[model samples]
Target: MLANKRILLIIGGGIAAYKTPDLIRRLRERGASVTPVLTSAGAEFVTPLTVAAVAGTPVHTQLFDLTTEAEMGHIQLSRSADLVIVAPATADLMAKMANGLANDLASTLLMATDTPVMIAPAMNVRMWDHPATQRNLATLKADGIRVIGPNEGDMACGEYGPGRMSEPLEIVAAAEAALSDGPLKGKRVIVTSGPTQEPIDPVRYISNRSSGAQGTAIGKALVALGAEVVFVTGPADVPPPEGVQVVRVETAVQMLDAVQAALPADAAVFAAAVADWRVAQAASSKMKKEKGEIPTLSFAENPDILATVSQMTKGRPPLVVGFAAETDNVIAHATAKRLRKGCDWIVANDVSPATGTFGGTQNTVHVISDDGVEDWPKMAKDAVAERLAQRIAGALVG
Candidate 1:
């Protein structure tokens, strides 16, 4: 997807450093040129020749290399790219960036370059969750740095949680999107996603069929476009996006609290399939089956979060977006819901037995607004998110 793009690829120390060679080749195949810079730790796992061979360029290593000074000055090298990427970004590298440590060539180039920077962190699970590392990550995000995965999976350390480098293909897509002038830049957007689990006991509750793929994709697309995204997620089957600010919640009440905290955004997208009813009085302990004939459960209504946000007079988002998952008369009901809830738009899609849109990667969605309903062709969740994000930005800046 990246054509005619220049990327400064900095390889950091970690087992994941081995993937950088293939990463370089993929970038070149997509018509992007890569200038490789190796960290001291990176050299231990992979040789300089391997990187140079794949990059088809002489690798840059030292901070005070006399040969490189005679040819390409460090100043020239730092700003020659459209983007800077640090793959296999170790905890040390992350801390160094956070503290503005410029002792090394890679760290110095990072601080000196004005171009947008992206990092794909690869560290042990414990290191990833360390208080210092977490604080550093928050600092980086607040500074407008874009980060890709450090995804959750089996690691070289024989542990699994959330500290694996993103696949090369995934990083390439982010690079392509960053180089392009996205249509949704500069919009402040909020998206609520997934099923809320209301507690019946400590162990049981009610939820929905929301897989959360579409909602999280929307957040990612907005972030890629330079929009400020606040993702309020419930008990989602999928994890949140890499760069967006995520507020995790479980019950409907908790979701409301998160929404209020993320307010004053430009747009609010209520994509979560929140449960309509919850247990009024949940037992602390699991009920014994021996004494019960059949449990008569008491139910109560959940607060209409979409309507509340839509009707807010102060600190309300400009364009409020909501979703309607209906069995019949989908468009008509969704259109009525928009009017009733005072929202600007509603995206209606069939979640019935015949259709597999629920929890599926592909969706055929109908966009309902005051203008009219537009039947969009079936597309991937990520594509849908981009289109919606673009429209949100257009509406905000119109």
Candidate 2:
């Protein structure tokens, strides 16, 4: 899929830079040519000679090299690539890109590039969670830069949380998606996944059993079809897919706000299992358990994200899809929900304990629309997502 593609790969200064040689090799294996731009800090981690050797191209480092500048200016070099990728995009590098600072060759190329850009962030857990870094991340996403991963696992720093760079093959997959000219190439989509957490206190919260597997699968399928996906997700067991903008939220209100912020899309899919209610007055501190006494809790309804978006007076998505997880009478309930919520379609499924649909890999779904219910055979969640994505592509661009 990446045959004859030109990828300008920027290696940032991080332990994960060691993976770039492999990334370059993989890209080359698929007929993609990689031009390596090694930062000064990146050079400290991996030698420029090594990068040049692996990529089979001269490593571009100096911002003002007399020899190279005469041959090809930075502007020309930046615009030559089909896609520019920053693997192990450090926090410092991301901040520079977000703020539009171009002090070095990598940042300068990023600022000057007209080509689509993708970054695989790698940083310490604390750095990744910092508010400033997150703000920069949001800014970058708003500017239409695609992000792959900083997958969660044991980091080199001995602390564990979402700060590891994605593996090389995963990056390759994302690159393929970015370069795909599929049916939904120009379309933008919003996909909400996972279970929203309604905080009751500093520690306790109300949530559901949604594993986010289905939603993640949907996001991946959409990306594969060439849709620019804005994945607004909650805390889920499964990680958000690469090649999409991921907005993380904790509550239904936050999710709604995030979705609203990502509006004007071709379609919106609400696959999240949001908590219906939240504690009216959550305790500031943890509520202590007392012997022979039960604490009375007051409940308030959470925001109806699906209904609100579906009933939008302005800037509504062309197609609004909602998910209905029913215990019984799946088709009937889902059909009713499609009308009641004012959504264009409803992907309904039985989530009873016997079905194991909530967190399981397989699902039996009924696609409910204005025409009627279309009951689908039981299939893997990934297969369901692929079929749904095809249908969505047909609706939007066929």
Candidate 3:
């Protein structure tokens, strides 16, 4: 899919810089031409000669090289590519990009580029979780920059969390998706997945059995179809899919806010199994056992995200799809939910223990609409997502 594409790759100053040679090789294997830009810090981890050898192109490292400047200015080089990618985008680099600082070659190229940009972040767990880094990340996303991964794993720092740069193949897939001109090209979608956690105290919370598999699949499917997807997700067993804008939230209220912020999209899919209620007054600390006495708790209803979005008088998505996980009377309940929630369609599934649907790979679903219910045979969650994505594409593009 990336045949003959030009990729301007910026290698940041991080331990993950060692992987850029492999990333360059992968991009070349798929018929992409990569131009490497090595930061001074990046050169400490990987030699410029190695990068140049793998990419089969001269590495550009200096912002003010008199000889190179005469041949091609930084602005011209930046604008010459179809896409610019920053691998192992360090915290400092991200901060520079977010704050629009152009003191160096990498940041200068990033600031000058009109081509779409994707970054694969790599940092220590603490740096990834720091409020300042997260704030910068949010700023970058808001500016329409695409983020690949910072997958979770043991880092070079011997710590574990979400700060690992994505594997080379994953970055390739994301790059292809970013450059795709599929049926849903130019369309925007919002997909909510996973189960919201309602905190009862500092440690305990109320949640559900949602694994986020289906939602993640849906996000992937949409991206494959060339739609710009804003994935609003809660805590789930599954990680958010690559190549889509991911918004993480912990409660129904936060999910709603994220969804709304991602709006003005062509479609919105409410696939999350959000908690329906939360403790009205949760304890500040862990509730201790008190001599065989049960602690009484009051419940408050969570906001109905589907209903709120579906009933929007202005700026409502053209197509609003909601999911219903019914234990019994699947079609009956789901059909009623369609009318009650004021959505365009309802994807209903039986989540009873017998169905093994909730954390399982296969799913049997009924697509409920005003016309009637279409019972679909059991299939893998990925297949279901692909089918649903096709239908969404048809609805939006046709």
Candidate 4:
């Protein structure tokens, strides 16, 4: 699973740094290219020559070297890997990362790299259990850096607790998982998010209250599962997720165009709360206040993107999921919408004012399909997204 993957291994100063040479060997055995970065303290435990010999690559130990810098700049080195791993991530190193300090070469690389990062923490029992260390760990996790283990057992300092770094083989396994293309890997998926605006005039437009939180979460989940996601987003309160190709549009028509351009996907999830109608004859200029005069405006129906894609004769995705954000009788309305829209499934949710489903963080939804409706409990937007993505993966794999 780790075949041909590029790993930037940053070794921190710790007694566990000795285990990293074996970690590099096992990774190389699995066809991964291991690039080593040895910290000053780390070099005290393991020589650069030993690290280089095991990795079969030159070890990076300096922040500034004319010879290497001319070949590959620090920024390039930081971003030129599929993953960045910090084995024996010391308390000092973790603290630097948590506080965004980039004084040293290792910390600089960690701050600059856009690649995924994983850490194997090793420290003294008391240090590992310190409140400051715990807080830093939480911050790192929240930032999406994966943590392997600090297993409980004997420590090199002769103290017993959860301060030992995991064995080399176990760390290798985690690395493989991190680099592996998941079940949905190589699959292309289209996700539409947020609310479209229908222009009423140059200065103003009509739009929905969708914050795009649900859609952003869904995109993140899909990417985590290794899917190539094309995220078509409208103007929203929440920002889009990282690690996906984003296509931004303002109106329903523009969104449809973007979606059509990103076609030939394995699946399509229409989560955008697109405006149903648009001003047929909007004034070119903003209407000014006038006494005893009321301007009348006509409307035209906007394109039905979900229905149009669901019923495509050619190049239709294998799975088509539409969303029904209704105010009342959500299940009944969503079930009917699924059949009418000719979509494979409909995620139905109540968006009534009382429910706070428009721009809220949590959601209670039902998954409606030809089989039946599955009731999902209210949960955080990200949890809902993960469950939905897993279900999609199963359907696609089957």
Candidate 1 Cα deviation (angstroms), residue 169: 1.0
Off by over 4 Å in 2: 14-18, 90-103, 122-139, 150-164, 199-205, 239-242, 245-250, 257-264, 283-289, 313-315
Q: TM-scores of the models, in the given order?
A: 0.74, 0.84, 0.83, 0.59
* Per-residue lDDT of model 1, residues 1-398, tens digit only: 47888889999999999999999998999999999999999999989999999999989889888877776567777899988999988999989899999988899898888888888899999998899998898778657676676766899999987788888876776676566666555455788988899988888888888999989998888877766566788878898875554667888888988798566677899999998989999999997677548888999998889988999989888889999999899888998999999999999988887778878888878999989999998899899988888778778775
Please provide, for model 2 over 1-398, each residue's C-alpha lDDT reduced to its tens digit, 9 standing for 90 to 100: 79999999999999999999999999999999999999999998999999999999899999999987887678888999999999989999999999999999999999999999999999999999899998898898778887777777898889998888989987898888889999987678999999999989999999999999999999999999988888899999998987776777899999999898777788999999999999999899999999999999999999999999999999899999999999998888888888999999999999999999988999999998878889999999999999999999988987
Q: Could you give candidate 4's per-residue lDDT for residues 266-291 as a string of tens digits?
A: 99999999999999987798888699
Best by TM-score: 2
TM-score of decoy 3: 0.83
Candidate 1, pairs of clashing residues: none
Q: Candidate 2: deviation at residue 81, Å? A: 2.2
**Runs in model 4 with CA error above 4 Å?**
1-4, 7-180
For model 3, residues 1-398, the per-residue Cα lDDT tens digits are 89999999999999999999999999999999999999999999999999999999899999999987887689888999998999989999999999999999999999989999989999999998899998898888778787777777788889988899988987888888888989987677999999999999999999999999999999999999988788889998998887776667899999998898676778999999999999999889999989989989899999999999999999999999999999999999999999999999999999999999999999999999877989999999999999999999999988
Error in Å for residue 197 of model 1: 5.6
Judge candidate 2 at residue 11 and give its lDDT: 96
Better of 1 and 3 by TM-score: 3
Of 2 and 4, which scores higher on lDDT? 2
